[model samples]
Target chain A: MARLSSENLETAYEIIARYPVKKSALIPLLHLAQEQDGWVTDVAMAHIAELVEVTPAEVIGTCTFYEMFKRKPVGKYVVNICTNISCQLLGGEELLHHAEQKLAIKAGATTADGLFTIEDVECIAACTEAPCLQVNYRYFHKITHGEFDSLIDDLKAGTRDEIPAHGTLAKVRQHIPAARRAGAVAPTDRAEPVWLIRNRQEGAS
Target chain B: MTMNDVPKIITSRFDQGDAHTLDGYRRTHGYEGLAAALEKTPQQVADEVKAASLLGRGGAGFPAGIKWTLAPANVWPRYLVVNGDESEPGTYKDRMLLERDPHQLIEGVLIACYAVGCGQAFLYIRGEMAHAQERMAAALNEAYAAGFVGKNILGTDFSVDVVLHWGAGAYIVGEETALIESLEGNRGMPRLKPPFFPAAKGLYMQPTIVNNVETLSNLPWIIRNGVDEWNKLGAETSKGTRVFAVSGHVNNPGVFEVEFGVTTFRDIIFDPKFAGGIRGGKALKAFIPGGASAPWFYEEHLDLPLEKVAIDRAGSMLGSGAIVVMDEDTDMVKAALRLVRFFARESCGKCTPCREGTTWMEKIMQRILDGHGRPEDVALLMDTADNISVDFMWPPRMTTICPLGQSATTPIASAVMRFKDEFERYVGGPIELNVTVKGAAFIGPPTRKKEGSGV
Candidate 1:
């Protein structure tokens, strides 16, 4: 077990003080220690217990309670796939399998190269696009087996760069002049067409 | 929003009778829970609830009786806040209860108010959920017209009012304090904990009891069915039936009430009576045992029971009982990127780590996905995550202000930890410019401004 650094202890106390119930800040404090050390160790839990004036059992209990906190060391990149109702109906299961096979690691296991850790997540709320996944924090929607393979291949090949610029509503309006007009298909409605078309296209294939 | 409303639990009582209308509610068993409670001692009501062993169904499996008992008794004009803002991604069980069974929620609210000595109850719904708002409002009006909601209910001196408030469509508002803030007309940012426990100081500074839609809905049933009977349905630690919204990779995806520990992932996912497994014999890739923020589970964890304790042991959570399944043919990097995008967008921007961390993480993810990543950037991404996580520990305690801030890094941190190779694969690659914009922007004020302006 790694020693809980003084810095992490101080940080934990600071968080506990901010909340009405020190226990409430437990999740965030664990996040900090894990962030600093790359994982939550037993030593860290003991320090958090001291900071929050709770028992080590309590700290560990809360840590083990939530899914977000990492008790063990993880890989460098986490692939979170959405396999909820919407994403499932949209082929989330198949996409997940493809990812696991391509990465050569089952979901929840780090790759042999220590480069990737794949996880399955619940609904991302981008149901309209369906079958979505998040590499790090960016969303890739309306994915297909081919698209999924290509995304991994591109990541592997290091051929894709530059974050997709956030396209403002204005940019969307510029593309479809009718969008700016009143009663022009609502932006949400307009957005659905692409995904719907993609779904149909994939279905046809 | 339609006439084909199905009466599940609460609505069954209101819909079958004229109780949906104010006059009808008066004639029927409207406010009966409150009336029953008012006749008995508050302690007795609390005891009954405790005996019921009812647990909160809004993600955390907190005991309802324990929550009510925690409220400081000295505080007057206490509040009973109902969290109707069902924003936990893939968890729509509450919406069904709120829209179709509003009266049940109302009765449960009144009972909870009476038990906790609360004077008012507020139902905070997401701003986007206009239809739910309408149905709830109409239900409240009916209760009021029937003399259940307004002053001097049933000729007893006790009076309580149920108010409906709309949120600005923020997922963070689902947090109790944040919901209180939004109800109070502030930006829907979550407050720091320790001194902010809603039971002690909530709403406009008074003791409060915040329960989720499903939790409150369960109250009337608990009262109807003794705690022992309710506890008989599930595990000893987690008693009673829970409503799970099963979605993703299932033949039939909908909400089903199953006893705690009585169901398994395979039973739900592969059972023809339930989800019936992934479509078209597609192989299962991963599964999110809870809401979006919960850690992912692979096929190895399939037989794991879909219960709080079981999932927790598996390094995941049974969050809101929203089981999202992913199949083969999915990209791990892209999936992680999508979740990161959600955290970035949904972040209330109150805490530095969450606000900047989520945005930066999204950017890094995008770069990797777009094929513009550098090998060293992988470590940089980890460093950035480390920095944000440090910030995540501040403010609300030296971390971000609320669960939103802390949870914002969940997908990114987990992804980077679990899928580093996939991220490394994207390093040193030319950017893939195959970005396609699918839908019109969601109907909301522009979150990002034109270039040159301070975003």
Candidate 2:
């Protein structure tokens, strides 16, 4: 029952224009769909399929393969805590338990109030600052139980201005001027570089 | 031991707060390398890099210069893909470079694009790194405004466009071929080689050169200072410095840029300048020489140098330059499980051996930690690991299409080989240990299809 807004449709068209091939924008459009609707609805996938000139089944194939795109609806803030080796060594497992208790939800469940979703994720590549977690993909490194509680409280109170909703990748949207584009096209009349020809000749001799 | 000072070439501006901006980057000898490179032909620029002998920093330390040449001659519209997908469990240096100093990366991209004759370049960053994506996107916009990227770069005859693409989370996309698949809006599964080598047949089935972020980041310095000056450091094989991210149990757990082939593991882990030794005066039990994929090295191998040949000869690779140290109190069985679980979860399900073998390994490791371990679980785990990796050897001979499948076995082989007693200690019954699998709801025993009730 979800659809991209007129503004988002324009944005999507602009994004597709950036790529040499239309199909290459499928992943980015899926992200845009998620951004517009929180989770990718069936309608949005079919819409994206139409946009990219691929079947809905093909869209599903690419969407399901990636871990970031949520197939089902999640809460506003998706708290992904790392429990891989580095974080595990630094009390990451205990931290997950603490988060579970605080949110009143298990690892893969959404809270009853629809405010938080907890996930025991793989490494977010912030190993140095072990025991790291991300709220809607914004990093809080080397977090403690107290710091985590305050973060939850802030998110619940809607006071954390920096952390946006789920699927919002960045604050700034990229806008490329048409003149600045690389104009990438399959070459038919390109000439061989002088250096390569020289190398080939030198080898022949 | 050569105790020469490790020069900070790529990361010289890391401490500067505003280095991500165009004006700030210009002040710090930033675009000077591009200017120096612009003075020469693309081939001459590539020749300079070959002379410097820069090795790729993304796990496999292949020569970056040689990789650029592998793209067939006159393969028009050959692409340059800059791999910012630093997803290896313990690695995080690329994130720092992307977040703190993006223009330096952009300059590196420009130099590479010009050298390789690519009309378009793709910078693929992993999705989990939101900050990195934002910083890079903003930096790319700044770069385009400054005429550093896009058509007619810097008022010269040369023109190229650099596109900043963020990947949806998939670890296998770190593989070059798989990355290309992901770029093409397909599942991030690796293609079979021989026909799909990125250099020969890549994006849109044209020749392509894929370089790591750190590898390309070295180009500016190499171009600006010349090869002889850049070659002053490092050893016979690895000819430059590398950023080693040290984490776990270490006092100063962070990224450090050190000259390659000079410092040893002992110096990196225990030295005051690096990780500053294990925390709380704890003794070192084991350490992953590279990221989670590399086999664990023990106390005996601490004296081995950080050289590629030295580490390779020592039966583990310095893959991804991520060093994770485990102290004496750390439970080896639990540690092994954590790594195997990562590989299993991120398997991508392209290869059956990888998809099933990693899961099998994880289940066994989980069972061992959960007080339900069978006596034959250790051998069973080893056999499963061997089936995936083909053997318990360094430079692993893999059964799957990519090294990811082989990566699952390193922890198993290393843990069982050295810490067999620890794994054995967890066997036979409900052993109450602090290392219990907390999130058991996610990974439980597979359900048996009730006594052959054919539906």
Candidate 3:
């Protein structure tokens, strides 16, 4: 197990302090541990248990409970494909097959080169873009078999930029076109009927 | 396309632009409810809420008024928690509200705090939703700056402060008690029920009211619209509109709102205006009425009214209203395997049943999918799921832990029950999976690519 530096430990403590209850820091602490060591280990779990004043069993229970936490070492990039109802109906199975065939490994298995691991995730909450995959926590939406293959090729060629660490909001904005962001009117904007819109204009008082 | 596209109830006020921003919200009578709420006594506010009969929109259909009344009276520093950790697989309604109309949620939080004598409130959001957290925090800052939140709210003696706390993104955090624990900086595992209900001993051991994001978001409207008016929109028992996240094989796969009893699955899915049924004339196989955790239904159940009671009566839940449809080509075994795999992976492992039970279920499903199933495995899977305990007792039941164990069994149980033939077919031979390409022939060998090898 990799030893977490004092800085990471302090950051964990700081995150716990921010919450009203120390236990709520379990997920954040695990994240911190992973951020520092790339994966959680038994030694780190023990240390987290001691720091949080919980039993080692409790820490282990938490680490194993959530799917996001890695019990074993993972590849540099994780591809989580959504095969839930929405995605499945939209040809998610084909996409998954394509992904497995392209990577030459089944879902939940890492590639031989240690570059990627593919996982079949449940709904990723991005059902709008059916057949989506989260490549290393960054979402790739509206994926097709051909598009996925090309994406892999781009990644292999180093043309696709490395996903930035702290630019998720920017990434989301980038995903949504500028026109949609600026001109996409919400439901509230047209609350009244069209007659009302015309009446208000005609009867400006 | 416009308000015309949205049903009247859940989105009566949706078309009002900038409803998230203070000025935009106020122009559409947003905080007017707060003023109305403050004018009356707390008991009166509670009574009005009780009269409205609003149920929690975050999966559990518990009444909001009942939750408020359950809180201990005269407790100092009582807490109001907004369960914004929308981790349910099919659910994304809370995320939409938080990201698009945060102030509405904040206003609802304020009203809820006022009704329950809560001075401090926390919005526990899912951590993976960095954008939502940022949007909510920005809204909180705007509300605080405008004196809508924090010390002497709206120039009244009654004060409330709202803070945004992010969950590490676990589905269990959506459970109220677990949500309380997560808010307190602990692991987001759920505690035993009965003694640990959030109302009695919650959030640093103070009386707390943990309401779903949509539930809280409804308070301001309920107060402003009056209970009588609110009751007019929906059925007698389940009053008000619900935001349904319609995804799956539908044409218009987005969030839609409808009155409680008015919208049926047929109207929501087949209507040209709404979801527009399965895309490209694909035959519907089944649909998950709620999130992935909820039990699934076959095509025959399409006519089942998409209501809380009706769906529950059909042995499924209206959980998070994340309608996930499946078409004819969908593989039930693989789908069930994928769903169970998520629960297994996310099982917080607090109790043996959930941790081990989920793992066992996943393994069995995987075995079946991999064409390595024995006949006994089917009965064994059912027995294992049935024997799995739901109670998480002190010293750690090792056998039980909240409903995580029970919830994990749902997809498997439902899939086996509904699609028994599919599972049986895999046992006889090497399953020759079929793939149909719309405009192309069978592709060549699958492409092999390594991650981080530059595309």
Candidate 4:
């Protein structure tokens, strides 16, 4: 299915308008596209390229470089377990092993029904909450085995509604008035905007 | 060293539940700093920051006011980029400030943007910080609606537009130059020094001022309280309270704000007000005094001061103010391996020394952890690390475009030096080679010859 539907186009343009240059919105636009689909697809990448006015290769370069973007289909719920130094010292590795045993699948693998995918990720800057994990970017502080199992059960039963689907980044959308939106200037053009020139500054775009 | 019964700067507001909201922030005297700041000229505001003894809360601990002055004078439209990508393994005070008291950060941003005459600013937050990002984005909208941002901020002739950029998932973006490159829409790889420094030519090729989230977060407090009050909080060389993230094997493993040099590593670990001592009554074996990048410290060095120069003189650093505690049961080799693996994954494949050196060390560490280490491997590991490392010289030499390679090697070197006996146990032995393979099986050293009939 086409990920970036016509309904999302206006919202996409508003996001694009937030940057002085079109390419600067590449990452945010990718978040919007992923918000529409569970993971980034070739079609969605193409759609993003068209929306942001960049080549598909450029979009893919930015997308693949970041670990958050998934190239293939992800499970309904992506359980990202943080196993960096702080968490590792506090049973982060054991937690991952426990998860593997309970799920009957290794990390980076999804269940047969495709409800969950366990990923051993880098630090989320939440070192204070060790043995911590995130499901769809929502924190499950100091997660224990029992809590983990019940969380999986909750996800399987479709009971956890606080967090959105796998690809959704935010609960709120940004709406910029057309007048206040940053009009995109060509990369080749060195011409400055009235506001920038009024401040005696050259536009970095 | 300056000490108080409790912290007065950032942590003073932590008890308030609704501090994240604009109203709650105002109730706690948040935006008053920005209001007080707007009354003065940009240079006057800059002078007040210079008058204070504030050091960058980020690992580097560079003078924040000095950084503001480095932004090119003739260049107009200077940008202020706040590095909210707090991905260092043991460091996380930025996430706390962003989530708990967000408007304070926004107010700080407004003030910093004013001090440097930056018409635009960007908050480059890490991808995993969804809640932090959500709060910050909401705060920005609140700021715009309340006239704290946008055209003619606070009825002053100043106007600045702040952009919130989310990192997909690269730790290298924590570097200022790499952050700028990422904000411009590319891979978050560190740029070569010389011409690519942010202050000289930053985002979109303009003079830029990049500060840490916690560093800028303190600006509001310093601007409101005046320079003399801040200078009284820490050592002669260092000033103000730093919010430290205390994690791993500690009873009260959380963030703590303590005046620099006033508290020792011992106090941070055992003090009742801080981390209530190591968990389970286990003796402390070693600790990562800084984030993962800093060299590990042993139990004997508990008396070391928390000041940057003191810690640096002690052969470690007070990096990012992240104190990761380790108990007697902790495995130094395994811990070092995890750190190297983190760097390997987040290396960004930029310059040779970092990219190749990190992955190479990961493989070597994996072999060592797997009990396949040879007597020569320990020396080999040091050799590999030395190739990427830079000692504390005047210029501070480094092999990579960024400091990632250096960080990747720090743990290995320190762990090996402090725990040489541990490495010896695995030496002169081969791991279970036929070991049941699972997932990406043993991607051995690159130099491993192509064995077996080219099947």
Task: Report the Cα lDDT for residue B218, model 1.
Answer: 73
Winner by DockQ:
2
Q: What is the lDDT of residue A39 in candidate 3?
A: 75
**RMSD list, candidates in order:** 21.9, 8.2, 12.9, 8.4
lDDT of each: 0.63, 0.85, 0.70, 0.79
TM-score of each candidate structure, all chains considered together: 0.63, 0.93, 0.77, 0.91
Better of 2 and 3 by DockQ: 2
Rank by TM-score (best first): 2, 4, 3, 1
Model 1 lDDT, residue B22, Cα: 46
Could you give the DockQ of candidate 4?
0.42
Lowest lDDT sum, 10 consecutive residues, model 3 chain B, at B437-446
- lDDT (Cα, 0-100) at A156 in candidate 1: 63
lDDT (Cα, 0-100) at B198 in candidate 2: 93
Task: State which docking tier applies to candidate 4.
Answer: acceptable
Tell me the interface RMSD of model 2, in angstroms.
2.6
Highest-TM-score candidate: 2
DockQ of 3: 0.14
Tens digit per residue, CA lDDT, model 3, B1-455: 23244335434445666666778877877788888987876667889998888888988789999988887654555678888888777676887787777888888888887777775677787766656666687776667777777666777666655656656557777788888766655567788876888888787776778898888888888888788878876666678888888787777787888777557777787887778888889888777778876766665556666666666655567878888887787788888877888788778778877788889988988898898997667766766666563221111123464766766776766666556678888776323222221110011111321210111
Q: Which of candidates 1 and 2 reaches a greater TM-score?
A: 2
